[model samples]
Target chain A: MLDYSALRTVAAVIQTGSFEKAAGLLNVTPSAVSQRVKLIEERLGIVLIVRGSPCTATETGEWLCRHLENVGMLEEELLKQLPTLAAPDEARQRVTLHIATNADSLATWFLTAVANFTKQSHHLVNVAIDDEDHTAEWLQRGRVLAAVTSLEKPIQGCRHLSLGALRYRATASPDFMARHFPDGVTADALVSAPSLLFNQKDRLQARWIRQIIGRELAGPVHWLPSTQSFVDASLAGMGWGMNPELLVGEHLKAGRLVELRTQTPLDIPLYWQMNRLAADRLADLTREVVQTARLLLRHEGR
Target chain B: MLDYSALRTVAAVIQTGSFEKAAGLLNVTPSAVSQRVKLIEERLGIVLIVRGSPCTATETGEWLCRHLENVGMLEEELLKQLPTLAAPDEARQRVTLHIATNADSLATWFLTAVANFTKQSHHLVNVAIDDEDHTAEWLQRGRVLAAVTSLEKPIQGCRHLSLGALRYRATASPDFMARHFPDGVTADALVSAPSLLFNQKDRLQARWIRQIIGRELAGPVHWLPSTQSFVDASLAGMGWGMNPELLVGEHLKAGRLVELRTQTPLDIPLYWQMNRLAADRLADLTREVVQTARLLLRHEGR
Candidate 1:
């Protein structure tokens, strides 16, 4: 077994990026964290870390620390379900949920889903917005109880439920589309046409083109990177690209932009992937999401 | 940010079904884990857990504890990489790398890969064996820094490199194959033939049949969950199913087991996916695995 106290102190130090900051988070003097690491190293007979201005874990030390952390997470999750097993005075009162999500979901219906459950759920959520492709990884790590993912398969011991499809329209301001795709908008024309993307990792545009042309997506595509800018770039007619229907519904209705591909608009089926342990919470959240999807996106033909 | 310390303690209590056991693992008085959880609940303004003989986290509480675990894992991994950032003492040595791998890799080249990284890598490896499909989920929860996964794309902030193919051949004792596959079996005959699998999660038999016959695999397949048992069952003629080439090499050479297909094996391309962060120890370990693959399994073809 590894020395978890030493490990925890070391973790706090890394999180704060300095002994001083770690001390603040831990509510201990910086000297205490320092002394603990020293004693741990001496006892273990090995160097567990490398201290720079920002600090890092040595391979062996990091491996142990990572294991310790996993154990901690598993234990914590188990505790939530079995809190009443502890002594009366020791019974837990509040629960915290950590989730890795995307900015769109975080900013949009995700919070509403939480609100739907909050009346009966006395829990706080720590939402970290990352890419959808990687959100499911958090579930595998035992970090979050649930996640909104593009993946169809569930992680081990977890279950997956389809929420609804997110419809995307390839729209551009009429003037901008005319400026860039002036050659009567052939597939080839749009292939190299300047388009916007959420980030370097975003491949929505290429994916849209592939569906239409029946080939791999390979071409010159511009990256807008940020959600706001992606929408801005499309509205500005800098390029033609897909935009989430919810985000640009009004614009499309007002004719600010023209839908490029009427035949094929990108509609990704979204799924709610979660650990199977918390059956009630998962079911509630799933219901809330499905209900929201039905209310908000039913007309989009999912 | 939640009180991870409290969550860890509470989780331990539940796993061990006793605060005493949890305390022993936590290196604290059972009272400490007990008190910490009480305080955590008070601070959170919610009833997070229910205490009893075997503790259980409430739906709300489990949610939070899971998040705490995730952050704890990432934090632990980071600290291990940069331990000196906390103490900077010359005493700490030996970097650790925790990896969750499959049984075959652990019993075979995984250790060989470990042996290859001698210089600058005094590693403490925590090897976990599970199905390939589920390994990346472990990586996502911040449980391990790297993993051998079936995923083509990398996890968040991680890079994925192909490790070539893992070819599995359906083999059986020559006597067994001769008796079972009389008249040299056709694809359709496989539906009724008994087969072997690594575990309940093992789907190689179904996958292989699907690949060859373009249909679902449904038959009287025997379930030998352990790596050793799976091999033994096939050798004993209990069934014919997919087994790794390395384990079956000698038998194939000795004509003890007959290959089931003309294009007789299923090839699953393996990938070495790791966090993008540079660690001398991890780099050295990766180098060793790559070298071993080149020598042992590279020529099998992807």
Candidate 2:
């Protein structure tokens, strides 16, 4: 068992990539961070960091760091939701409904919903997106009040409503399409193309291709885990990708990206699930999500 | 936003049927429970329950009670796994793995898997069951480190493996078969019979019936939520049910209960999934599950 405070300090140091940076972020001296980390390693009975000029989280350290980050995020979210649980000075009386959502939505329709909450007294937003499937899990853990999920059934103790569908189009940059799919967007050519994915969890484009070709295709695909980079990778002609129409719509109309598949557009119907408590604030947030979903994704089609 | 402590006290009072009994269960005095409930009602801005010699959770109180119980159970598991975080006692040197599992599996194969973990001294087990699908949500929330899920795909950051098939024989007492399936044990008769579900979430019987008859065609059925009661209900001539062979094998052998749909024995394959970092532990556990799954479920095939 590692000392939590020490492990947290080590994690901060690793995340910031420097004890000094971690110390500043923690509002403590650099020596404090170093000492905490050293103490954590001693308690763990394992060397958690390779200490030198620049700190690196060891394999064990990274594991602990990830768990720490996960638990810390949830605990922070719990604190945000439970005002009475907090100290009097730290009390956040406003009911904040945290939701996990994609970056494109965050940049677009999601903010519109956030603005809708500004008229109300209290709200907080923490945007996180890597895999859509796990969003409902966020709701289950009480990390979020509600989530935009891909699943139909609501998690236990929650009620869900279908928001709408998000249509995804497989598009590639003109230059990349020319270089890779020069023979046209034929089944044979797609097999050899260097496609890109948002992350390892993404299989939309691959699933689409399998549906089209009636077989699975393999390629040495690049993984740009960041939202901005994933879209940029598509624009840079590095790979073909199934991107949300909203993200690539402008580029497609400008002829920067060619539609790889025109017939079978993936319509990912989204759902919003929340704890069924008839709280005024949670209800308001759900209404905002429904309104935003109707405007942004309703027209995308099923 | 609900006062959980108040809700829990009310529920304890109902379960025990007395303030003193509830207080003893909670390791608090009757006065303390009374004071807490009063504070909760004052804080919640609602009347929760009618205080008397024996207590009962109100409609709203019951709802909050359920949620509070869920939260408390999850937190207890969390405390057990993170003993260091929960308490100041113990050296806090080992990583504990919490797992959510159904009562039956926990009583049987799940424990066998734990017995195999004796060599690897890096983990502890926290077992609870909400539902199979919801179990992964527990893992997602970090309430549990792993789960035996019906889901084929891995939860985010988790890896999955097949645990082979668990064949369920739709069985009932001879009297039940005679009364419900008077025409015979044909697809049509089975559809019209009072079918038993393990719970609301348990769809094995429905799925089994649907494979033959299509849609819901069953008679008015009783939902016995407990696994043991579900089996007992069928045995008591309540309904036709899809019972695990392990649970009812002896009765079937003794010719006490008769199996229906012999040709279409409902086979539900189990899958084991866990966080990837616990590879060694998962490896040990998976090996045991495969071994136990072989011994427990393998022999029941038609």
Candidate 3:
């Protein structure tokens, strides 16, 4: 029901933050970009974008953008299947897919999936990083066509695939453990010792503390938001916090970091959520992600 | 006068996103935390925080938090100057300072300044990274006590000190240059070539294209948001992009990357802006940052 070209123009405007800039990127005149947006709004009979210094999409516009992205993926798949119907120049234009994920996943096995997908498909990726618990919000707001999230439920109109569990261990540097917990991890020592947190929204440390000590942890906290930096901070004896088993495996093996020896490691099950559009490219990407995740990540039940 | 302890409690609730969590951090009862927040709201006659799954500060509450942080810094400075009047327990608590900066700065010379300052002062830092142009908004919103920003003018109540300019050179990996621009960087080659960008908000590549070809660029762009990842992508022959001279100097020297040899490298002037509070700690921090910047960054007119 919507003009795919016009929708593409709308997305370009929001992404580039100006009609003029979008025109430059789209290789069209500024007036042409403006007219396309106007045409879409007229056809839809709703305000799509609030024109400003930096354009922002209205709620309806965001949904349209997401739809356009999915449609683009479907078109790519169609052209691949039926080369006779494709334009001669169609192969030159690679589809750009926007995905939302957490920093840890991106720094770990997720990129392996992305690299594998891009090798076989003519698609470029734009990744938006947020907390695992919050990545679904980006998908709901239509900022991303797909998301890697911890939520078990799928967003409306989206299909969910379980990627498997990312196990995490509470770890600290060897020197830090000896210095801070010489007498073992008592409540009194934990109350005075320093701890590292990924962010205020991160509840891994709190959950781990409640599990280990059966009480809340009131400690000096250092918030490092970057995944690599969080690992570095922990390795440099700044504090101890949960690190993904995949990331800390080398350090643990090298004897640089020591596990706190809890009863069980924390396992956060990740799900791949995508719009339920019949797109071969999306399906291919989903298959690659699932296959790669299963190979690298821990199985949910096992 | 407002009770600084109550003000701190209010900040913790907003930061940790729950009164119960803030109580645990403060080593107090949840009811006591609620009472303190209520007392402050009544005294200020303004709604400070919105109760929600994750709490957020109202506009007025943000200002109060900033004020509380400044007061804490000033109190620490006062105790340092007149140790005789200080409570014995005050020395044990390190004051935490929140600052806003750009990623390039953090990945380059800013850590040295932080390390030096931490060694000399009993202060821990929490840094929030935003674009250099937008860090002023964080300062204006009272989310940070200081910011490293590109704006020359100070926010209404902040002091601005010029920290010199960061020079950027457009560079590409040796192999990529040989493949894409074999005959040198012509406008035709640029039109069809893949390019790297930090994000959609980044205009460095477009600006460089306009400067060189006198027209806007219409090319394929890969948006890489992480500084280290951006550099790695460039190094891995993903595409050509502008890199900070400080960051890519070694690569340039080692012949891993080659500069495109533009007419002039882009030099973005950076300034340190802080609230105009008479705190010696703030003054000391400003001095160290400026000193480190002058040593590493290019001077204004040079």
- The candidate scoring highest on DockQ is 3
Quote model 2's TM-score for chain B: 0.64
Q: Each prediction's TM-score against the native?
A: 0.43, 0.38, 0.83
Question: Model 3: per-residue lDDT, tens digit, A1-302?
Answer: 76877888898898777899889878899999999899889988999998985688899987887677666677777787898895766566667788888878876777667656655655777878888988998887777878999989988978898998888888988888988899988888887667777776787777888888887766766666767666766776767888988888999899899987644588888999986653344777788789889998899457
- Report the lDDT tens digits of candidate 1 across residue range A188-244: 676455555554345566577667766433333443334434455566555566777
DockQ of predicted candidate 1: 0.01
Candidate 3: the clashing residue pairs are none
Docking class of 2: incorrect
lDDT tens per residue, model 1, B43-115: 8777665766345667776556445544544555577788766744212222334566665654445556653
Off by over 4 Å in 2: A1-97, A118-121, A277-280, A299-302, B1-302
For candidate 3, write residues B1-302 as lDDT tens digits.
78778888898898777899899878899999999999989988998988885787888877787787677777777887898995776566657788888878876777567646654655667778877888898888778888999989878998988999888888888888887898888887886666777775676677777777788766776666766666666776767888888888899889998887544588888999987763345877788899999999999566
| iRMSD for every model | 28.7, 28.6, 2.9
Where is model 2 chain A poorest over a 10-residue stretch in terms of lDDT?
Answer: A89-98
Candidate order (TM-score): 3, 1, 2
- Candidate 2 achieves a global lDDT of 0.63
Model 2 residue B222 distance off true place after TM-score fit, in angstroms: 49
DockQ of each: 0.01, 0.01, 0.36
Off by over 4 Å in 1: A1-4, A38-96, A114-130, A141-145, A277-294, A297-302, B1-302
Question: Residue B231's C-alpha lDDT in candidate 1?
Answer: 62
Most lDDT-accurate candidate: 3
